[model samples]
Target chain A: MEMYWLLGLPLAGGITLAFWGHRAHAPEINAAFSLATLIAAGWLTAHIVAEGPVLIGGDGWFYIDAFNVFLVALTAFVAFTTALFSRPYMRIEQAHGRVNAARLRLYHASYQLFIGTMLLALTTNNMGILWVAMEAATLTTVLLVSLYRTPAALEAAWKYFILCGVGIALALFGTILLYFAAEQVLGAGGGALSWTHLNAVKTRLEPVVLQLAFVFLLVGYGTKVGLVPLHSWLPDAHGEGPTPISAVLSGLLLNVALYAVMRSKVLVDGALGGASLAGALMMGFGLLSVLVAALLIRRQTDVKRMFAYSSIEHMGLITFAFGMGGMVASFAALLHMTVHSLTKSAIFYAVGHATQKAGTQVMEDIRGLIKTNPTIGWGLILGTIAILGVPPFGVFASEFLIITTTMHQHPWATPVLLTALGVAFAAMFGRVQPMVFGETTLPRLPHQPALLPVFVHLALVLMLGLFIPGYLAHWYRQAACLLGG
Target chain B: MSLTYHLQVVNLLAALLLLIAFAMLSQRRIVGLITLFAWQGAALATSTAIVAWSTGQHHLYYSAALTLGLKVVLVPWYFFRLIRQLDVDREVEPMINIPTTMLIGIILVIFAFNLALPISQMAGTVTRSTLGIALASVLLAFLMMITRSKAIPQVIGFLAMENGLFFAATSATYGMPLVVELGVALDVLVAVFVLGIFFFHIRETFDSMDLKHMERLREK
Candidate 1:
């Protein structure tokens, strides 16, 4: 089945790379595995389009709907491109003596395993399995985040482990509460935890218990989504890890966490019978994250850390859009999720090469990117422009939809959202322009940088900005309907 | 009468579990904390087994065995070995003193009981009353994590929190499906191993297990 290949290849690749990832060709092998995963994801996407949503495996363990199927494809595509970018990036890290053979092996193995766990989390129908997958993803990435074994890296990993560990423990308690409510209706069995069955009988579930569960689930997964107050671990993790890991953490992992939150939102909304309690909570957190992260971006000296804050801000906008909960808002949230992941990862790719060329992570130390290498500089500038919601880009289109929807639905919040957007735009452009355009002091790298994936992602964003294909638009409408206000 | 007797025993164990959680909150020595964590795990396993026997939810028996094997025996053994190897078995000074931590733990327990009252009423399981104690222990563990500055005790705090969650699952829903329980158990075991590896790395890097040395990554 297409589902098997889609899930099994990364798992298989993880195992193979764990054993032989120290070889010189390991980066190529890693890319090959990711490409195969993308192909499998492509095949699975086609199958879903042809046959519609499906429940695969024994007892219908893997649920693939229009909601998650597109995310699965996007996850696979971004992961593959990240692997392409990392090939050269990791090689450069090795050339600099930043990582040796064993660490490289660890990075490659954990990379595949991380992708597998995210895919598993996205597909699993069981809430408990989803929790396990999310925890496993955390474990795999903690090691990768600390791959360099520097003091900062270890501290970041430790903070990531403890904070997320505690947060996820709360989520498990929430899951137990959900099961407690469900078993009263469905009886003691596996069906009590299956999302499909729960959704079918959601109306009959206890509203009080569902409300409590959603709070815990949101705070728990929201910690991973880099929502503020719970977001301290995120920027450090991004700032300290290898650039490729930062790319996926920003572009893919945060999206997966947001997807988990949205899934829980749907169930809670159904149980509450048109009450907007969950939506109100999401809106509060989302707006707070945007306002806080936009301001925090100005204080960042590390480029990756600054961009990580931007990710929090963008995720906030998407979460806010979803919280508004209507056809147009949900569609905009989905589009924002797509564009943000593409644009952010592309930006990280450019940042990665820029740091390598300048041999420092501090924004002030890196200068004259345009003079040193035009391709990397242009890539960084363009990606930043796209991400800042400049016109004729996918991010702009999505942000436009989100802002317009907010204005119509919740006029009181519109001015505040615009203020945050303006602050974030000024902060980002002010910091990035000097880094990209000003100086010629940096040296060129020995090897050719991989700018292809950067351009590839940017081109896709441009196309989506200009025109969204009919099938994709239809898909978004179906998914938005499934995620009803 | 037999059913009531079983319930009484479970309640007594739940009380003992709460006592150990409070003790862990006040314990200053890392060794004492790990020992208390193991005791908490023992109480949890005994209570889970009792629930399984009384309710005949056979899958809960496997969960009980897992708690015993992983929490009581294997993880504690690993912690003992790890502390011995890392030379970090010293007295840990909490950021807040002991009496204050205990006071906060008490308040948390009261809050947890209040929160659990309505939810426990809705739970049909015979052991549902223990849900309050379960939640209280989780909060106590979280409090312990926040107050401790050392790396190892904080990890113990995390493991204790997991024990509390397991207690909640068994008390509320008679344990999850066998498959889910197995997956959760495997994840906990792997987490312990991974954290153990990090202990050596952290010690090697910082030259001490105190987390204060890790304040290098903060914003200016």
Candidate 2:
């Protein structure tokens, strides 16, 4: 019942908020719902910790394990912080005439719905529900992405909708194929499409069908994960959408998509009898995304787009680590997910404030953030340093594990990973340094900016880097085991 | 009806469906393409109903009804209304010329048949032979989407591709569970309405429905 509340609170709140959020207190209402959702997530996490991995509502509707519980908690936390940040950020956007009152309502409402759909994707054990939730997320984010109603925003939203729509349609076909494969073994209806049941009977599934299904599933979800070759939509969507939406896209939605892929990967791994085919495909795509994003990040003019590519690069590294597939690697990958989400979202929040202060998103146009607003300036620099995998940040810890694991298990791929990370660091810091440390282009806004979310998230990442809490380590271990580590 | 006779009827309808897919690919006018798309859906509904009758799967009758209602009646009605509202009911030029498009469609059909051969043999259904046609229409629809430069035709191609997938589902595995079918139907409806809204936005922004204008958003 509590599990239902964890998913229900935001969903109902978001829908209701949409109708009334245009009033005087939209952001407060938004933040209140988000905080309530976060508390419920914390409560659910405490319960799961107390009692191991509960399945509620019977027969495959809601299943929570260590794997998803961490994600659920992380998603809620990031969403709440972003909602808090969006309050001031969106208000400033309105002041600048970039947004108006009606769009403000749309932003607040869509933001909550985005959180709702992502939570749905995380908690549901039914494969059909998972696909539906993912599609719903795309739709909600589409509204938010085009909320600005610029030509570029509309184009980005259209591209996101079409690409993800086609990709998800293909995934649905794959899910149907998975059902077809499971039907012969588990009978026709009911639990056949259930993940728990499919995972239980995975080994008995026909290899050819499962193989074909995984191919479609990988391409489909890989598009959402921002894997290269299928990732043309990612940078545009991120760059063109509202900054808060960009933060959510980078920080949360991508992780949920990867979580879905990993869910499917576990079954495919079992069906393949520990074969390396699935792993190799992931590794190939992961490497390609990392390399492409690294190279592309340097040439980007839009600050948001640059970080969007950085997101693709980080997701690539995480996907590569997960593809490596062992106790150390999967643990590192999961840790990387948590840290990357934190660090990247922090970076986006700082970037959002800095860009607004500078009155532009063009990298070359903005200058001397430190002289104008030292707090935001340093926040951007520090967040960039953390995301680029400097030490004393959680991303560094996770990247270190990934590198060491790859060195032991995949020596040849190690250099590629190293080179990509190095390039990404140079690209990010090189672009950001000018903005943070040069002569001013525009005067800083008079109002005090919201720097709390940035500092809060960065502090969390720093803490995780310095010390892995006992519970988090144990949680990662249990989740790694679930992934067949 | 005899089982073999019913299977033959499914095969004939499957052929008609593929032919209509090809016709849609080669179609030059927006209204004509919509009409062809409706005919393709009508063919798919007939084939599905025949298969359901032959196999004694009662739910597929409902499936057939849904497909007929959504694909044959409602969606095309929405499209016709949209084209009338948008005043874009004119020539639809392919990015690739018509002859080359037809040639490419033929090749896709052949490739789809080759791809479906091994898989179809594994399917134990009365409509197993139609699996190749289903796959072929899907690929052809994809090809149509690729070759069409106009927004509305590309959307039609997407819907047609969904038709192919639905037909594949029925032929390969007696269709997806009814709940999924309903969800997918609703999703298609919603997607179409959403895209219809986008048509106005695109037209307002660029004063045209050509997708080439969106290419300006690509990374420099």
Candidate 3:
């Protein structure tokens, strides 16, 4: 019963928003539903931490685990915040009349469905079901992306759909290969498709077949992770979609994709004597992505696109942490995941407000924010600092951990990571600080900023920076150990 | 003997599907592209039917029937309607020309064959070799997608890629489950309908179906 509400609250909000969204520009509805979800997520998070993983069954095929509980809570939290953020941002949109009730309905519904699909992807014990859930996520996001009905939005949606659809079809092929490999070990039938079942009998799985499946799964899901070469959809999706959608794309969607890649990473590591090849691949792509995104960030004029690239950079860094294959690095990866989610979401929320305040996403168009709206200006200033890995922020802690881990092993790569970080830092602070603090007289704005969600995430990020909870530190330590790096 | 007979027919059909995919890639005429896509779908339906017959899977026959009806008949009909309604231009200016596309198609075939080598060897089926051709066709269709300038041609390219995927499934594993096949068929239908709507949307925005115009929309 409780399991249903874990998925239902956002969905119900979506339905209600869709039905009466026109006459009723109800930020209250958005607030109410989202807050309810956050509370549910908080409850679930505490429950899971206290009680181990709470298993909700989709008949016998599905069950949640500890890993999924964290993701579900994260998704719900980020979503609820984005919704709270959306209340103000979308009303400005509503005022702009760029979107009508129908479009709002689409956005609301697709947002909930996307979050639900992501949670479903993370939780379900069945691997095939996981693939389908991810596919559902891809499809739902397509509609949300095209909601603005601009030509650019339409094209972005089409590109996103085609590329991701093709990529997911490849993932399905990979899943089929995994099933065959597992069937050879576990015998044919549903048993072949269950992750828990496969993990139990992982030793019997053939190394060569699993290796091949790993390639397919990586290339397939890596596209979603916005790994270089397969990352074209991401910038466009983030650039043209509504800002809340951008927040979700950066904050939640990318994490889900990385989580997918990590799942396969875990499976192959257990099967193939450990994740040497996968680790090497992850490192190669991760570093390359960091280098490329770091360079690319220097040239971006669109504020949204710049942050979109930052997302790629951070995800790259996180992937590199995972690739290093040490307990510390893995812990860093976990922390980076946490800090990055909080920080990036907060940054996007600020960027969205900045865009609204300035009447454009172009950086040059938006100036003197500090002179105009100090709340959002400070938000951007803090976010830019937090994202760039300034001291006493959670991002800094995680990034330092990642760097320290790199220093212990791959000393050669440390300079490159540092260089990339320096470049990214300069490029980001270069554009953003000016917009936040310098000059004067930007346009006056009527939009309300949701003070709570932004502050909540920032406070969390700050707290992590200031103090590490022993319980979470222990949990992550254990998880990293279990991950064997 | 029945198995061999079915195998040879499926193999021949798979080869034809690849050829059609290649032709669609190189073809300039919008009408011709749509025709080739229809032909590819017919081949897919035929091969699916052959697999069904040899395997004695009753559901596979339903898959073939659905493919035939949806891809070969209904989709082609819809394209014709789009052509008539849009009534714009005949010649499509591809991003790359015929010679280069065919060259790329050949290279993609080599890559596909290399990719399929191990997987095909593992499969204990007569149509296993066809997997390479199916993959090649899929790649070739993707190449078509990258090359084409017109919205209609890209859509055609997309449908042909789906044909390649379907053929790959049938060749590599006899076919996906009935539910999956039905889902894909429905997806195609919905996709085409959506694309039809998008075509009008694009036309209303730009006054042309040429994707080259869309290059202007790309971020500076």
Candidate 4:
């Protein structure tokens, strides 16, 4: 019941917001709805903590365990904060005539729908439902990505739609294959489609079929997760979409997709008799994505695109950590998900405000953010520091765990990982510092920037860096156990 | 019907589906490509119904009806309407020439057959031999998508590829659950509508329908 409300609130809010988006208070409505959903998520999380895991819906259509309850909470929390940030940022765009009321309605509507689909993807015990929800997310974000209706925006949206569309179609094929494999063992019907049942019977499944299914599923969901060679769509989608959309794209949607991959990875790993073929494949893709994104980040002229590449890099690191497949590595990967979501959303919020003030996303043209708006400049720098894994931030804590664990377990990967991380750090800071501290190139636009969400996120990351609360640590540890089992 | 005769008939329909897929790949005219797509869908539906009838799977009857309604009749109707409204039914020149594409399509078909051999042997379905044809059609549709310069033809290719996947599901594992099939059908419909709207936006943005125009958005 509580779980349904956690899913229902955002969906209901999204529909209502869409209907009332032309009203002057639409942003407020969006914020209130998001806050309501966040509260419900928190309530659900508390319940899970008190009661162990919660499985609702007949045959467990909705399952909330240690692994995903935290993610759901994180998704809602970030959505709420991004909503707060979007209020000011979007209003500024409206003032600049970059958006009209009709577009606002679309934005608010799709924003909620995006949240709903991600939540659906995260919660559903049915693999088919998960794929549907993922596809729904892609569709809604496609609308949002093309919101600006510029040639570039359309191009980005088109590429995103076609690439992900094909990728997910292949994923569907993989899903069907999995069903075929499971049907023979589980004896068909709904039990074969349920995650709990599939995981229970995973070791008994056929290896060849499961291997083929995993390959397709890997390429399919991996496209959504923005793995290298399949990640051409990520930067474009991020660069062209609204800043809030970009925030959610990095902070929430990508994680949901990776979560799907991780679930499938566990099954594939089990079926492969600990051969770790799936882990090696994931590590290969992860290392390549990190290296590719690191190099790509240096070439980016657009601030949003640069961060988009940074997202790919971080997602790669998380994938790599999970691929390492130990208790500590999975723990670190989960923590990385949390910290990356918080810190990256903060960075996007700051970047959104800064770009709005400077009237361009072009980094070199929009200089002296610190000089013109000290709040935004420092926020951007601080947020970037948090993302770049500096000390006293949660990212550094997780990255440190990942590095040390990799050195102990897979010594060969550590140098490559460190070099990629190093290259990414250099590329990011080298582009960002000049933008923050250089001479002001554009006149400051008049607006009350939303700095609250940015600061709030930064503060949370800072707290998490120094200390993770006991209950939270226990939650991650439990999830790690489940993942590594 | 005798089992061998029914299997042969299914194989014949599968061959027709593959031929249409190749025809779609080499097709230069938009309307002709769409017609090829509809024919491919018709062939797929016939084969699915035949498989369902011969095997008595029963659920695949619903699947056959869906393919006929959505693919053979409704989707092509939608595409025809879309092309009519756009008033841009021009030639769809390939990025690679037609002969090269056909040659590549033949190679892909051979490759798909080889790849499907092991999997098809694993599948116990009577229509297992058609699995190679299904895989070939899927690859050929993908090749069409890569070679076509026009957006609508690419979309048609995507739809055709879905047809192959549907056939693959039927041949390999007697089709997915009815609910998942319905969901996928609805999804494909909604995706087409979304892509339709995007077509207008893309054309409006660039004053043309060439995907080549979109290359400008790439990183330098």
Compare the candidates by DockQ and give the number of the best one: 1
Note the chain A TM-score of all models in turn. Answer: 0.99, 0.99, 0.96, 0.98
Candidates, ranked, lDDT: 1, 4, 2, 3
Candidate 4 lDDT by residue in tens digits, B47-117:
88998889888989999999999998988898888878887776556556778889989999999999888
lDDT of 2 at A388: 89
- The RMSD (Cα, Å) of candidate 4 is 1.6
RMSD of each: 1.0, 1.7, 2.9, 1.6
Residues A325-427 of candidate 1 have per-residue lDDT tens digits of 9999999999999999999999999999999999888898887799889999999999999999998999999999999988899999999899999999999
Candidate 1: fraction of native contacts reproduced: 0.85
- DockQ, all models: 0.86, 0.52, 0.29, 0.66
Report the TM-score of the second chain of model 2 against its true counterpart.
0.97
lDDT of 1 at A200: 93
TM-score of chain B of 3: 0.95
Candidate 2: residue B124 lDDT (0-100): 71
Candidate 3 per-residue lDDT, tens place, B119-209, comes to 8887755688988898898788888877777788877777777787777767666665454456567667766776787777777777888
TM-score of each: 0.99, 0.97, 0.92, 0.97
Off by over 4 Å in 2: none
Q: Model 3, which residues run further than 4 Å from truth?
A: A7-21, A25-47, A50-59, B57-96, B176-194, B216-220
In model 1, the clashing pairs are A368-A439
What class would a CAPRI assessor give candidate 3's docking? acceptable
True contacts kept of each: 0.85, 0.24, 0.05, 0.54
True contacts kept of 3: 0.05
Candidate 3 chain B, run of 10 with poorest lDDT = B211-220
